[model samples]
Target: MSCCHAASWLSCARLVQRADALRIIRRVPMPGYDVSFLITAQHLAGPGARQQLVDWLVGFVMECDAEINGLKLDINARGRAVATSLLRSLAF
Candidate 1:
């Protein structure tokens, strides 16, 4: 993805949060290919908040026709486990 695409994705992810705000954890460019980003929800709402965020993300990916094979989410430092699980569940 291009920088614009990454920025757009980050902006959309920010809209899903209501607390500390969304932040970009990291951005890695895959030489000549897609760029990968690690984003996190700043402050969560409740127990299911993370899952809900993930759901929104899956929808966002689908809507954008973005290949999310390397998407990473860090919900309060739970790290890649939850993200991987969610992405796998979404079959992306």
Candidate 2:
């Protein structure tokens, strides 16, 4: 998790291990658990931008939850299908 503040970002940026990993994270286009959003004061200057940020965050969370649930269901279904097939192939 990120503190989501500039000072915290700076301090974390200073850390050696994190800094190295961060360099890779930046260079590579891969998803990571820790995220940093650099929002400037001007971003909140207008009510529209602020609302958009909130809406986008809400969607982000919802989409993550939905994707996770879908993956779990798919895994369970595949496992059950395999078990059923194995059972049918064997003598009762």
Candidate 3:
């Protein structure tokens, strides 16, 4: 028997994906949520780095039951793109 509740987890994953996709095109409003984080390219420069980050992300979402509403990547001064924030509720 599975200890995890699959339905809610899948729904949350879907919501996060949809939010991220929408955020790619334009700014979106995120109400009732305040969750954000940054992941730099330097941290993901080695083998299994992406997978490790994904693992941590999954754990974070499940543990916090967070509702993500936006995702954005920004280019730094050195011309490197980095995942700046997973969700930004504030106006840009």
Candidate 4:
């Protein structure tokens, strides 16, 4: 899969078509679950002598998962703030 495609998928909760996800990442709150895979031309050949590639991928995945959870908390907090503001405005 294209790194672009993988990054795009990991960047958000919804499926995006024909857009650059890296650019989109700045705008969307990270999804509740973050999972990513980036395999370059060299990585495919790394199985022969670069076992380190596997280790790096494992670490990358863990980091993404943590980031996703953090983003979810931020999004939820923002939603609650907005709701609270709306309720206060209507309280007279």
Ranking by lDDT: 2, 1, 4, 3
Candidate 2 lDDT at 25 equals 24
lDDT string, candidate 2, 1-92, tens digits: 34344434544444424334223223333466454444566656776867765665565456446656766787899999999999999956
lDDT of 4 at 3: 31
lDDT of 4 by residue, 5-88 (tens): 344456433322212332222233445634333445654453553455554445545655766677688789999999999999
Residue 52 of candidate 4: its Cα lDDT? 56
- Residue 85's lDDT within candidate 2 is 95
lDDT top scorer:
2
lDDT of 3 by residue, 1-92 (tens): 01134434675565466435323212332444355444567557779867766766676566444322211122242234223342243436
Candidate 4 Cα deviation (angstroms), residue 52: 1.8
| Best prediction by TM-score | 2
Tens digits of per-residue lDDT for model 1 on 13-83? 55334212333222454466453445545424568767756765566566455433234332334666778
Q: How close is candidate 2 to the true structure, as a TM-score?
A: 0.57
**Cα deviation of 23, candidate 4, in Å:** 22
Judged by lDDT against the true structure, how good is candidate 2?
A: 0.54
Model 4: clashing residue pairs?
Answer: none
Question: On a 0 to 100 scale, what is the lDDT of residue 55 in model 1?
Answer: 63
What's the alpha carbon RMSD for model 1? 16.8
Return the number of clashes found in candidate 3. Answer: 0
RMSD of each: 16.8, 12.4, 19.2, 10.4
Task: Give stretches of model 2 more than 4 Å off.
Answer: 1-36
True lDDT of residue 72, candidate 2: 78
